[model samples]
Target: MSLSQQRRFPRRRTSVGASRDFVTGVLIEWQLHSLIEDIELCVSELATNALLHGAPPGREFSVGLHRVEELVRLEVRDSGPGQPVVQCPDDDACSGRGLRLVRALADDFGINDHIVGKTVWLVFKAPAAPAPAPAPLTTPGSS
Candidate 1:
């Protein structure tokens, strides 16, 4: 089965938490409860980056979630210039480590440059689908 959902968020400080909540709700609806924490963390970081660095004035950022079979993909898109970097800042620095943390948590991560902006995406392995139950056995004369 394949599922896809997306939502746009304004360029504001509050959007980071909104983005996390959005993805969490979607995951719960999809029955992927096991991934809520990791996915939520990634969404928060990416949304923060978008709000701070990527979302241009009057332009909105968007979050996309897609699931195909046992694979789930999360994406954050924005219309600002310059690509995001994974930096290993000094230990004392309180910020600039979001991308680095994302890289460590995601099973697969990459960037897609669009004509206007870019999309940062992360992939995760979802739990396998449950097996179907067997039909009840019946005796020769059973109804």
Candidate 2:
């Protein structure tokens, strides 16, 4: 079965931590322990980006989680102009590497530009479902 959940956060700095917590809760509910770390990091980066650069004055952004079969998709949508890009900042630059992390950990990455804003999404390949336990071995003579 497929699963989906989403939340919208304001452009406040605290929203960054809130978004991380939100995603963590959802991942836990879905029993996706193996993916919590990477997904949390990605969500933090995206949410931070949205807060710092994407969210316009008095506007909010959204975070979404979706699972379909073996694939999980994470999305962050912001109502701001211009798309975010990964740039090679100077060594002295203390920031501007979040997208790079998203690119590295995510199995796939892409952005969808809408008329009003853009949605940056990351796709991860979920671990295969555990195989059912083998039927208990039995001897034909055993009643």
Highest lDDT model number: 1
**Which pairs clash in model 2?**
none
lDDT tens per residue, model 1, 40-130: 9999999999988999999999999999999999999999999999998998999999999988999999999999999999999998988
C-alpha RMSD by candidate, in order = 1.9, 1.0
After TM-score superposition, the amount by which residue 44's alpha carbon in candidate 2 deviates from its true location, in angstroms, is: 0.7
Measured with C-alpha atoms, the lDDT of residue 42 in candidate 1 is 95
TM-score of every candidate: 0.92, 0.96
* Model 2 misplacement above 4 A: none
Positional deviation of 98 in candidate 1, in angstroms?
0.7
Q: How does residue 3 of candidate 1 score in lDDT? A: 99
What is the clash tally of candidate 2?
0
